[model samples]
Every structure is written in structure tokens, then in C-alpha cells.
Target: MNADHADDSLLICRTLGGCPDATRARATGLDADGMDFAVAVAGIEVPVRIPFARRISERAEIRQEVVRMYEQACDALGVPPRSAERNSRSRPGLK
Candidate 1:
């Protein structure tokens, strides 16, 4: 992901861990291969599968790359981490 998307991406992942408010998603790494991650809630394991890269690019330069990736996963699952969707889709302006 580019620098501009870094913030959104990171926000997405961090928010996904709100289900039990204990476990957090962790990223292993990324490269030409697919994504690698783990779900540990309250220090326990949660079933999860991370999506790998589809294209070639340099690794994330930011320090929060892993968190961003996790948030992306949460978004895919339609669950924003720490999410409330205040001005979300159902909001008047969204439609």
C-alpha cells in the first residue's frame, strides 16, 4: 500500500480486534507470496486467514504496516475494529 493509504489500512486492522476486546490480530510478513497472520483473542487463538499480495511491490515502509494489514482484514469481514460507523453507510450523507 502507498503512504496515503497507510492510515486507513492501519485503522481498519486495529478496529477488527474489538469482538472480545482482548485478542488482537497479528501479521507475520508479506512478500511475493500471500499474507500471513494470526488471531489471538485474550491470548487465545482465533481462526483467521490473511490474504496475500496479488501484485509486486516493495514492503511497507511505515512502522504500523502490520496493524494496517490486520485492519484491512477486518474491513473485508465487514467489521471495523473499534468501529461505531458514526457517519457510516446508513448515515444520510453516505447514500
Candidate 2:
């Protein structure tokens, strides 16, 4: 299911804001049935595709699935997940 432009703003903002290296206010223009946004990860601009969905429930489900898929892809690529990195840095007694 493809989501229209109006439906995905919150997810976009949240996703962008969560990363320290993200472009902050930059998002690529829409193409086809999806839109691309870039976030700086490990000093690299990583493009994330946001798909369209017709309803909020579908969007919610899509968000969960997308997160799961992204984690899997990171594992396959031998890249660390963002949360792991963030948490590692935040704990006081661990260097």
C-alpha cells in the first residue's frame, strides 16, 4: 500500500530528528509511490524510503515493519543499529 504525501509527515519528522547526524530539515522530493529522505549515519548520507499508505493504521503497521526490516538489513550489512550506538554512549560507567 502506498501512502500519500499528507500522511507521512510525523513519521518523517520523528525519524529525522532521532538521529544526531540527520539533515534536520532536508528531505528529497517524492518519486513514484514513495519518498526518499536522507540521514547522516557514520558520516554517510543514507537514503530511507517512505512508502504510502491510505490509513493511519496501515501507516503504523508499516512503520513497525520498516523498522524491523531496517534492523535486519543492518545486521546483514554488518552495520550497528542506531539505538545500540546511542545507548552505548549514554551509559555512564562503560567506555
Candidate 1 is scored at a TM of 0.34
- In candidate 2, stretches whose alpha carbon ends up further than 4 angstroms from where it belongs are 1-57, 87-95
Q: Cα RMSDs of all predictions?
A: 8.8, 10.1
User: Can you give the lDDT of residue 46 in candidate 2?
Assistant: 65
User: What are the per-residue Cα lDDT tens digits for candidate 1 across 1-95?
Assistant: 43343333333334433333423444445555444445455666654433443443556533344455554655566665534665654421111
Each prediction's total of clashing residue pairs, residues at least 3 apart in sequence or on different chains, is 11, 4
lDDT comparing candidate 2 with the true structure: 0.44
Ten-residue segment with the worst summed lDDT in candidate 1? 86-95
TM-scores of the candidates in the order shown: 0.34, 0.33
Model 2 TM-score, 2 decimals = 0.33
Model 2, range 7-94, lDDT digits (tens) per residue? 1232343342344334332356544344466544566666666654322344456555445544554454455665767756332211
